[model samples]
Target: MSLVLAGTVAGLVLGDAWLWVAVEWSPPAYAGFYASGGFDTPTTVALLVAAPVKAALLWLILRAPAPGPLDRRARALRRLLYLAVAHALVLWYPIALLPDVVGAVFQLALWSAIDVLYLLVIRWRSRMLRAAAGVAFAVELAGTADEVLDELDLPELGSSEVAAAVLMLGGAAAIIITLVGQRRDGRWSRGTQAAGWLSVGVYALVIPFGVFFEGIPGGGPVLPVVMGVMALVGTVWLAATARELPVEDRPADPPPARRRVTRVAVAAVAMLPVIALIHPEQTPHLTHTGWSPACYDRPGFGDLKPAERDAAFLCRARSTDGGVPPMFPDGLSDQEVLAYGRVLCRAKDHDEQEAVLTRAGSARAAWGADPWDLVYVCPEIVGAAHPELLRSAAETEAANDAHIAEMNAECRDPWPRTKGVVQATARYFLFADGDHGYLVHDPGDESAEGEMDQAIDELYDDGDALVGAVGSTVLVGHVEDVTDLCLTVKAFRTAPPRRLAGWDQVTEVPVVSRSGRLTVPELDGGDAGAGAPMPNLAIAGKGRYRLRVHVRVGDAGEEHLVVVFPGASRKRLELKS
Candidate 1:
């Protein structure tokens, strides 16, 4: 029964916030063990079985006839044992198990109430303690009922809040009453008597079934109700079983100072283990070297060994000496190599470290191959020169930007404005160079306009113009000829160059005005520049003409340009020299 009580308290503690406290107090080694599934089966069963056994053993010991006076050390050991049992039943078990939030609140209330009742009983030798204890028990019953009502999601105060509030208030009142009763009786030691009786009730009634109740299927509601019924049954049984012993037969109190000292010693010993249990620390000898079972040792880990495991751990350590080694040397498999590569790519490597990256164009490809192996085998190949790399990177960047824009369009959100500016700037440079190249500029600041202008001036020194600011969105074009040709613009914000195709011819007609104006014949045999202000025209072909504006600023506060071509191809535009 005592074991059962301790186990019940333990369960309550486990399910409540006390469990978190226990976790915090647990030694690092224990915590690691707990984390690694050490407590999953055996520990749980031990706790359940041990509580009742300990309680029964204590009951038997306490009932045993008094022995001859013991040695000091023996007495101390006995006291220590008693204290250990009390602390475990009162603190450890309660905090480690039991799921009822309201039950916990009620249990605390009952404890307090019983304390008060015992105080009153000792002070007056009055029958009022039993009544008071009964009343306290009743309050606990009411609180549990309230909790059940709340779980049904009734309109009343949900769950334990109201029950806890009532318990605390009622318990406080009971304590005050008991204190007053004790003072009136001039019995300063009544508190101790009350505690003894309460302990008896806790041992005999609360634990046995408390442990049993928690184990039942659908136990939550049923357990509390059954416990309440049991409390009533137990109260009746105690009343029926009550027997009057002669007053002189009761144990006499020891001297006040000695008794106080004894109680203090007992409490101190009881608290030692609790304190130790509460503030767990790590020991050097029990360090864990492997991954936690909760994480790395889970299901599907078996699928990870050959390729996933190898790729994840091996390739990363591979040497920097270039050229692929046999798929795996030294018993290492391809998957392991890939895994190593993947991990290595993410790790910090020196500048000269030549890393291999396998390009799986899509996610499907990525998942299909051993992902880890792909990490090492994938080559991050870039153009040799800075300009070429920049150009390729810019095209790749532009394509990415366009894809984002497409997604944004479907979502009806404004396209990213910064991307437009970058794309336009990249296009302007790409056209002037007439070949793919890298854009060398300070990455620390977005104000790459100065660097862009320098690149433009150096690349196209004659008869070229930069007519757009970084933040404009519209693009316009003028040209002098008509011909079949392809126009490609590699934007820094796009993933790849955009090839505008199907042009007949192209001609660069010089503008006479500083405002960058030029005129060219229209497709309908009329002057296309006649009634409008002309921009300098680089015409594509004679009859069916297309034009390209190297750079233009738009009204929507973004910058980009339209490279006009009749079809999508990389063929060069024919320039009339």
Candidate 2:
């Protein structure tokens, strides 16, 4: 019990620590997904509850009275144990939202099948736990596969259907094997044993899978691999100890309750209150108020007096327009809009001002069409103090244009500025930049020379290369080329050359030196001399951005992308070249 408690605490702490470390070490390409927070109080609650509940369930099963004629108690206890382990694991797991409710449903279905199999065929509780844990590993593999498919631009293949199908096939195969084994011998068949061993192998395989596909889940490699290692260890322990350490003899009487079982039961009972004490009722944090421009026509606004209606209009307009980046008509200047805004601000009664503005709008709408956004009598708000209110309509239009431009220049829209990915068209290139920049090679415009520098620079630091707040460590120069070379963009893996939206473009760019046409396309085409930066290298930000072109090393099958940081010593510089 003491060992279990200590290990549980250690596991929790280590899991949390590793989560943070993974977040820290994750590549820039995958960092966007993790920019939001991770495991919350719910995960902690789940973890705290899982172990005790499992122990309690196990104790109950151990204490159940034996069956009179048939092994009914054993069968019942097997079912209970299966339910316990499966529920515990499911509760402990933090499900991702992308797959939504389907993920949970699939998890339930897959784990339940494993549970049923253990209940029907497997006699040893150890094998049952191991098999259930193996299913968990399989689920992780399915999840990783989905992520990999998404990255590869095969989104259709990455759907929940694929994951569910894979899990179902695996589950069905295991079940069929178990059934076949049951027919061969009442004790258990070779097929069942084979399946159990195969499960162990599958569970063990996840550690390597996590290592290889660390960048796939955006959750980093450490956590998944650690989880796999733990699962494998548990599986092995259970399998080895099952026969030697059977819980009790399957006899007519209930087994004597051992001190360990009693202790486990007491601990489980105690955990309920602790869980209740620590349980959190999550209250959503309201970030902003939702207001719409078209709310005036809704139920509440009807039947108001003209003055009140104007006030309502003003309220709605101000709620939507205030604090937002000012964008007046083309002719309006920022100074003029500010001046008008200041005039509007002078009105002591907002409702009265709204009424006046409404009337003005009505008159304009009746006589000639006026833009809804154009505050027609804006200057008139201060007509008593300033004679400029009597200015010609043409002057007002010009002022409005000037106001808009000036406001836009001064006030940056937070959404665009803070967004992780800035999707924009530059020449024919569909360029998106966050922590790293990605350039889709749409070469409608032959000279992409100076077009992408600003977008590229925004993602990376000036001079030597330091990635921006929302930039990938490795900037993808071009995704569409012959090789499906995987490059690390900071902590994430980005492979390219798949189809994207918009015009088709040439993958390779012609290179020109002091001498005309230095290298022919085919003769020196493949990742040779540093031609126009293809999506061929990891970004090395040394004060400036440098592309580390990966070249084949000797005649070996394996290849490594050279690490090039600009302004480094000759060794690094030569590597960059």
Candidate 3:
């Protein structure tokens, strides 16, 4: 039993290491999804692997012999491990299958209570603590069968829910049996206690590996083979070492003073890293080379500034009016611009406060009413600013027109012009923001110009002009062109002709349009709820899209359109009266 526990702990630690290796070597391949947006395979795998590893290690250590004086300690450790495993498994399994956020919170709270009870029991043996632990474990077991039964979509019998329930219940039963057996024997060995402590160490080591490797890239395709190999090797190594280990015995009666001190020290050390990990003050470093000056104004932004000031530049600007102007014109040099911009942005100017930023340019461009920038800046503006202009209709038609034009001008064969054009548009949106910019080609291609790049030069000159006008940090030239491109070629729209029960039905509604334009006449029912057919649209542009629904729902509810896209998906817009 002691050897098994030790092996389990060792396996967990090794598994974690293997997981980390997997993440570093092989990332998941997600087709049709943006690289920036996808599931984290490594992290999931790590968490899954860590849980079992921890349980096994704890079980093995408790089975090991304890020094003469602290025989009860072995029993206490065993009980704690058993309770923890049961609580964690019950909560984790149900949450994974059903994924109810509120229910998960409740389960976490229950688990926390169990932990507290376990700690109290170890402090002083009371019938109440033992009862609490038993009740907690029992509740976990009872809930398991029902939760497993409810997961109808699960494939294979005795897998997923059944498998999970068996492991947890079996572990719990084993602990109870072991406790009864130990009481009959009247002797605890030091080997058993060592095995338990070793298990914890193994668990700690395995966690990082599992998180980094197995999960992120996923155990799909050929990765499972790698995982199996790692698990086997880890298990074998641990088993071999655990068998020959020696047990140390302590005095039959140790003063209570020393035991208390040791427990306190262990607890304090364990909490140090956890505290650091969750500290509210810790700020993550930003990896992106290009973040808008506006981001600097965000709280904790100063923590991320590069150490070498010379490597970066800051641009500062401010609008005299509370309203943001279309452009800022200040010809401050690049260095001066970055310094000032940083200050202004940090100030969080509402009206006349100076905006500051750090960048490679002299000043930042204020994004005006351009649809693309509006989508980037205050997305609500797209719907609020222009009532007559249908952004989706105009954008889609423009893209179609652009595609046709490009095909005629470049491809001439009409073979695969759309793909190339679409690719070009994607690239443009990906890298369009900030000072070091590229120009949109005739067919919507973005080519980085060398020292003599005409587009970059033009943008730089135009940006300088705008910065001179507006004092705000972060300025750009020719936002109108970008907005025009997004509206015309990249936006797709679909709307229901009549009220529907759900969004799924809306996808089936044919987007019937005359001259590629949709019109919604004021109809009965509140502006947002069951009324006239809405014009639903999807924008394929690389950046964000904003929808403006036009109508009034009175006090009941306003009509709105749900827009889903790549980043920042699913926004609901109320129809303006």
Would you estimate the TM-scores of all the predictions? Answer: 0.23, 0.22, 0.25
How well is each residue in 155-246 modelled by candidate 2, as lDDT tens digits?
63335555555653554354344433333334432322333443444443453444334433344333433343334333322222222122
Candidate lDDT values, in order: 0.34, 0.35, 0.32
- Candidate 2 wrong stretches, greater than 4 Å: 1-443, 451-577
lDDT of 3 by residue, 376-428 (tens): 22224333554323244456456645654553232111112322112111101
- Which scores higher on lDDT, 1 or 2? 2
TM-score (C-alpha) between model 3 and the true structure: 0.25
Winner by lDDT between candidate 3 and candidate 1: 1
Tell me model 3's lDDT, rounded to 2 decimals.
0.32
Query: What's the CA error at residue 5 for candidate 2, in Å?
Result: 4.7
Q: For model 2, what is the error of residue 386's alpha carbon versus the real structure, in angstroms, after optimal superposition?
A: 37
Q: Which ten residues in a row have the lowest lDDT in candidate 1?
A: 237-246
Among these predictions, the greatest lDDT belongs to: 2
Per-candidate count of clashing residue pairs (backbone under 3 Å): 100, 28, 81
* Number of the predicted model whose TM-score against the real structure is largest: 3
**Native RMSD of candidate 1 (Å):** 22.4
The TM-score measured for candidate 2 stands at 0.22
Alpha carbon lDDT at 352, candidate 1: 15
Better lDDT candidate (2, 3): 2
